[model samples]
Target: MTDIAPASPRHQKNMYMRQNKVLKDKVESLELEVLHYKEQIDKLTLGDVPQIVKNWMNEYSLPWEIFWCFEHEKWIAELDNLFPYHMENCRCDKCES
Candidate 1:
């Protein structure tokens, strides 16, 4: 069997540099995507969001927290849909449904 030669130091460095650049570019792209998503979330929270979400936003100071709740706890949005009329008029601490 033929002996295999290891890569030279310079070749290894260039490969590492190329990998680093690729990783940096990926990170930058991900950061931009995150920023875009954050902007969209901000727009939704500040602009034409659902009234239930708006009410929850008023109740809780943090908009993202409320949005997160709606995302993870789908029952909240479902409950809101179930009782839209009651939710509109009522302003109690706990919703019956």
Candidate 2:
């Protein structure tokens, strides 16, 4: 096999610069794609309550649960308003009304 001459430093640097540019561009594009997917996930979860919050709600009783609902009312409504199934057997004065 014939030996090839090494590339000149200027040519090597130019090639390296081009490769660096390509890698940078690829990274930027991937970052944008990640941001896009994150936005999509956020949109899909916009009105969703986290499972941890659900579990926390399940761990409490009437007034405390109502307090939790009131405290988080900015992101959620009263517990009964959102989860009528659990409220079906509730005897709170607010629910009785």
Candidate 3:
């Protein structure tokens, strides 16, 4: 009768290595897709926002203008608390108008 031996640690290690390689390839493919999407987003919007935010805008058609307005208001309130006189005389477009 033939004795079937258990897989050695070396064999297990090789199996794990192959699995890791497959996972690495998948991760790299996903990363490339993310980069492609980022390039498309950069072409669409000529701004310096994060890629994730830009992608979210593109995917969901979110109202970024409204978000920016609220963000600016929050920033102004925080800045005003920190530097009241400076914020008051900032003379930026939002502040002026």
Which candidate wins on lDDT?
1
Q: Which stretches of candidate 1 lie over 4 Å from their true place?
A: 51-97
Model 3 clashing residue pairs (backbone): none
Candidate 3 per-residue C-alpha lDDT over 14-79 given as tens digits, one digit per residue, 9 for 90 to 100: 999999999999999999999976765564367565554456457657544322333233212112
Give the alpha carbon lDDT tens digit for every residue of 1-97 in model 1: 9998999999999999999999999999999999978866775557555676667667655443434333232223433443434444332233334
TM-score of candidate 1 to 2 decimals: 0.50
Candidate 2, residues 52-95, lDDT tens digits: the string is: 55654577532223332332233222345435446544333344
Q: Each model's C-alpha lDDT?
A: 0.58, 0.57, 0.54
- Per-residue error for 52 in candidate 1, Å, reads 9.9
Identify the candidate with maximal TM-score: 1
Which is better, 1 or 2, measured by lDDT? 1
RMSD versus native structure for model 1: 9.7
By how many angstroms RMSD does model 2 differ from the true structure?
12.6
Q: Model 2, residue 68: what's the lDDT?
A: 29
Q: Supply candidate 1's per-residue lDDT for 23.
A: 100
